[model samples]
Target: MAESKTNAMRLLDKSQIPYETLNYDHEDGQIHGTAVAEKIGRPQESVFKTLVAHQSGQISQICVFVIPVAEELDLKKAAKAAGAKKIEMLPVKDLLKWTGYIRGGCSPVGMKKLYPTFIDASAEGLKIIAVSAGRIGTQMELNPQQLAEQVKAVFFPLTKEA
Candidate 1:
């Protein structure tokens, strides 16, 4: 398959950030984060999914989170990290309206706006991490710290305890 370029990929290129693109079969329509991680042969902990959430009662106030595909977001922890009283996952229907990306294709980079972003603290020690390349079937692997820096994200405990 020919390589496809996405806004996230383009942004990384413009910033001169080093990243490797990984593609997997999306034709089956199984585009879940965990599936993508497994298909790419990367450890679950090293592949993250981008989630969008909103401050309770304030649809306008949004934040982005990047957590391991195998884990679930802890709303309490995420709220604390985001300095929000309460946080709720943004409805899938509104994802594109806000982040310009749909479920399973959201990327932490190149959102419609630079909303507050927080990466799971677990990613801190990782040499590299993979995130969506702003489209289904594509992912970009790069240094975790560099990914956070590029998106102005902070490391925080945002996942539920297993």
Candidate 2:
């Protein structure tokens, strides 16, 4: 059976941005980023996760952040990067409503709208990084710069230290 193309994959193709699709088994129900990385045989640091947040007191002021799955987003830094005095993760129930993606399948590439996306600065040093392909069990790997360019995302120190 052939896998179908996701919105993220289609968008990447239309933009002529080179990317490679990596698929994994999701039936086990271990869809978290770290488990996904292990299933895909990639380092956790190379597999990033997409998170959606909104400026405090303003649901309309939404933004996206991409960070290594193993790391946590520094809310303060994320807020600063997004120019919000305070930032809060969008409620899990609202994720699909806001980004047209559900948990474990959200990709920064092709969201409902482009909303001030940012990638962790650490990704800038990596040759390649993987993000969800807008579908569960699938991922896309490409140069960090190319991804940033495609999504108009800036690189920033959005993650917290261990």
Candidate 3:
């Protein structure tokens, strides 16, 4: 293919943001976030997944939470970030309908609409991170701060306490 382009990548390019795309072999089965990191040969801490959350089960108030692959999103913190009293993971079945991307390929960069986005505060220290490239079998690596700036995301505690 002559350079796989995605809306996320296009937006990054338009803004002159630098990023590197990594392609992997995606299998049909349970979507494992950690596996994507392994497949891309990156540490789990530097790879995040774009997960969509709903406020009180309302899609109209849907928000995106980008967190490390190995952590579970703290719903309470997510609700706080989205300015909602409650939040829950958007059902896997509704991933495409709401985010315009499938379970394994949702990037925080380019959604159908720019919903409120949040990144785990832990990510601030990392110089760079890998996130879904808005397509299966692909990922993009870039600075977390750049991603945050592009998405206008809040950095906060987003993972459940162990």
Per-residue CA lDDT of model 3 for 1-162, tens digit only, reads: 587699999999999999999988886553578988888899999999888988995767888999999999999989888889999889999888888898888999989889899999989999999999999888999999999999999899999998
What order do you get sorting by TM-score, best first? Answer: 2, 1, 3
- For residues 107-129, what per-residue lDDT tens digits would candidate 1 score against the true structure? 99999999999999999999999
lDDT of 1 at 29: 92
lDDT tens digits, residue span 58-101, model 2: 99899999999999999999998998899999999999999999
Number of backbone-clashing residue pairs for each candidate, in the order shown? 0, 0, 0
TM-score of each: 0.97, 0.98, 0.95
List of clashing residue pairs for candidate 2: none
Cα RMSD for candidate 2? 0.8
